[model samples]
Target chain A: MRRAFTEELQFISDQLVEMTRLTSTALDRATTALLTADLELAEAVISADDTIDLVRRDLDSRAVDVLARQQPVATDLRQLVMAMRMSSDLERMGDLARHVAKLTRLRYPHKVLRGPLEPMFTRMAEVAEDLVAEAGRIIANNDVEAVPQLLVTDDEMDELHREVFRTLLADDWGHGVEAAIDATLLSRYYERFGDHAVSIAQRVVYLVTGEWPEEDLHIEERMDVSRVEPLG
Target chain B: MRRAFTEELQFISDQLVEMTRLTSTALDRATTALLTADLELAEAVISADDTIDLVRRDLDSRAVDVLARQQPVATDLRQLVMAMRMSSDLERMGDLARHVAKLTRLRYPHKVLRGPLEPMFTRMAEVAEDLVAEAGRIIANNDVEAVPQLLVTDDEMDELHREVFRTLLADDWGHGVEAAIDATLLSRYYERFGDHAVSIAQRVVYLVTGEWPEEDLHIEERMDVSRVEPLG
Candidate 1:
């Protein structure tokens, strides 16, 4: 019975890693689609989101089943509960990717990120990729050390988010109000993607080390959006 | 043992209802702060968010404790799990309200919503209040009937979201790019608040009636963001 419980836990862990992989691929393709206005690629990303959602639902149900069968206590019970949460964070990451794809489709034949916005978003995508990949590794191997590096990557994503605002608010910005609105929403989608990845990594580290990262505990509050004040 | 489990479930349900109340107050006050540029009101909303987070943590720990002590199976296990999910949704609604307050504080003494944006946001806040209040009632009473009404309110929020874009993209938009960026982010925040409320209400209806709402299953995907297309 003990051996079977361990196997179930391992299966759930593997599915979570798979979710990270799917979201990473989705976000990468969505970025490419947005950059080039590739309608076909965007459509694919939008449609593939269902697979991620299904995986999450399957993983969550299995976790509950294990709880019902095994009646895990203490550390074991907490682990199952946290697995459900990690799956939620990953599912949301996939949703953010789909949001990007939908926006791309909404603006078909017209590239959404051009001029200064292009390079900042490109860098944001890179940071988001690194964060999700590291989150996957941490979950798979229980590598707590990778968390600090992941937090740094999240910082980069936040900086890029602020930079997007700066570019939009610049005096010579010629993209007009419409483009600014698009940039604002698109930048938020990418930044939120990174936030969800950081959340997953933090959960894994907590499960392994039993200690929440001190400085990054209230990460949702540390968004540094204060710097995003609009120019009068 | 069964009697104790029932009592514990009642406690968890009460806490969930309390969460809805806190978030409703937070959003309502945050909207006022944004429109009035009242720094103190915004500060109050921001600081009070920690209370909501604490309540969620307390509720979650208790839920886990009940799961361990009772070793409930089948529907009982599912109820505990779904309670955790509902608490998460409510906690996130609080975070969204905090986001609005933070934005308000960041732009102290400067109103974020003006002109046509004012009336629209006023209505969005009103809808948000209704959705959350109804979510509380549904959880408290298992009132499946309220779900349809809550969904209609969600649709109104979506329409308001589209109107926000139309106002920004109009040829005669007088606000600069900075204000437009702020408006875009703020509008998305209110819309997402509505989405989380709809998700909570749907979860309650599913738990009570054993049937998911057919039309609103994927509330996230039906965000109608496609209608937010930027004008050339």
Candidate 2:
């Protein structure tokens, strides 16, 4: 019975890892589509989100059922709950990626407006990539040590986002009305993606330490965004 | 036992309503502070976030515990899960409000540049104010019917956000540098606040429908954001 229960717990972990992988891929594809204006890629991301959403619901229902059936005790219980909550976060990430893809497929040509936003998007993609990988790694190994660093990645994502806003607001490069809105919304999606990553990391800490961190410290992003100004 | 459980749930519901009410006030306070450059008000909002965060965390943990202990079946289970998720949304709402407070507190002394953004922010505040109240009302009564209309409010928020970007990209309304970055970030924060509100409504749908909406209109919001650029 214990072995069967452990396998069930492992299955939940596997599902979380799958969602994290898909979310990261979606982010990557969305950025690629946005940078290259690949409508096909954008459409693909949009359609793919349906699958991710379906998996999320299926996994959540599965987690709840496991709770009902197994009555997960101690660490097992925490892991199951973590899976449930993280599914929402992962699903949101998929949604953010789809938004990026929509930007790629948007009727307005983003290439018309030249700005540093592409670089910012690239950096955001890298950070998101690392975050999803770390999330999967943590779940795979149940690593507590990595959770602290995920917070740092989230901070970095915020800084890049702030830079994107500063660039758009720059007198030399206003990113136009179309570009400005795209940049604004795009930056927000990435920032939120980071927040969910932070949420995943926080859950890891709780699971491992069995003590919720006293300080969220996740919100203490470095640098005052107000200090940021036009790069040019 | 059932009566006692109902009473406990009632107290929890009261706390949720009270939290939503105070946080909406906090949102207004933060926005007002941002618009008026009221450092005192901004500071108050920032400090108040602590209390809101505490309540949010306590409620979330308690909800999970209650669900685990009581093993609420059917409607009871759904309600408990919904509370857990909504409290998380409320916590994020608090964060967004505090973010606006940071903007207000940080951007002090730099007078807001009069541009198209001011109107956008005004509209956004109006929409956000109404939606925030609506979320509380829906939660208080568990009214699923009200969610569809609230979903439209999220769409309007997107429209205003797009308008702000269009203005930023506008060639005529260039406001130089200092006030522009502040304005851009300010609008972005408002947009994000709206996103959190939409997330809350989505959870309400999930609570009622027992699944994520077939059409995730909110996720694609930023995807279509670049489409509203003013024609030359």
Candidate 3:
């Protein structure tokens, strides 16, 4: 019974790792669709979400079954529980991916965004994909060292995201209003995906080290976000 | 030993309930800030995040301690694992609330989003907050019946989100590109937060019932999404 239970957990963990990898790839493809204005690839990403949803359902069910039948305790239980939560996060990340894909679909042919916005998308895509891969590796190797990698990637993503906001908010960025709006919405999607990826990485670090990395997280979440000064 | 373990598990469960409540309240404030453009409330919400983060770290440490020390098997183990997992989800949901709050600080002034757009925000807020609360109640009471509440709330959020999208994307809508972009990003944040809440409710339901909602989440997920046909 003990051996079977361990095997079941490992099986679930492996599946989680696999599903996470696929989720990352989905985001990567969706980004490509957006940048290259490929409606077909975007549609494929949208349809492919069904598969992620299925994997998510499977993972959730399997985690529950393992909990019921095998009855996990302490460390093993934590791993199983973490896997289930990460499954939901990864699945939602896939949805955001589809949202980007939807953007590609909506604005195809005419290229609604400004040419300068391309690097922002490129940087967003790079960081998003790297974080996904990082999360997958975290689960697979159960590595403690991967936390920094994820943090650094989030930094890179946030910097690119700020640039996106600054350009749009600028007076003379000159994409005009409509294209600027497209750029803004797309930036929000990218930034949030980066946040989810950070959450996953945090979970992975905890799984391995049982440490919360509290100090580090505080720094990452820190922003110039301040009270809106009274209008002069 | 078993009784002590159960008590500790119950304590963690209580924390989860409390954390969920805190998140819901914060979300309420965040949405209010979004609607009223209350920079003070938005600032307060942003600052309050530290408390949420602290609670999250505490929960993680406790769960990990219970797991590594007790090595539980079965339902007892499941509860511990789920507690940890739920805490993380709640934590991230808090972050999403924080995101909404920060968006309010961006000077979009909720007053401008009047008429149906206004009601749409109100409706989205109601559903989002209720879903968070329902998920909490489900876990707190272990009420399987409450699972359907989340489903209904999710459906409502989706519908409202679609309405927002249609208005923003319509050529006759008359708003410039900036407003449209803002609407899309804001609605997405609301929609995705609702999705997380539903997923949490589903987990709570599955925790007790050993199954996810059988009525088809895939259809539900795609239903509210704006189906703007790709520009050929």
Best by DockQ: 1
- Winner of 2 and 3 under TM-score: 2
lDDT of 1 by residue, A37-89 (tens): 99999999989998998999899889999999999998899899999999999
Between candidates 1 and 3, the DockQ winner: 1
lDDT of 1 at A71: 99
Best by TM-score: 1
Cα lDDT tens digits, model 3, B138-205, are 88888888677678778777778767866665667665554555566667667767776776676676
RMSD of 1: 1.6
Q: Estimate each model's TM-score.
A: 0.97, 0.87, 0.77
Clashing pairs in 1: none
Any runs in candidate 3 off by more than 4 Å, and if so which?
Answer: A1-17, A53-89, A106-114, A134-150, A170-182, A207-210, A214-216, A219-232, B1-10, B60-76, B106-119, B167-181, B215-232
TM-score of chain A in every predicted structure: 0.96, 0.89, 0.90
Per-model DockQ: 0.66, 0.35, 0.29
Clashing pairs in 3: A71-B73, A71-B74, A73-B72, A74-B67
lDDT of 2 by residue, B1-232 (tens): 6886797688778888877887788888987887787889989988888888789777877776776667666667667667777787777777778877877777676545365566667778888888888888887887879987887987787778667656665678656544544566666666666666666767777777877775554454533444433332
Better of 1 and 3 by TM-score: 1
Q: Which residue segments of model 1 deviate by more than 4 Å? A: A227-232, B227-232
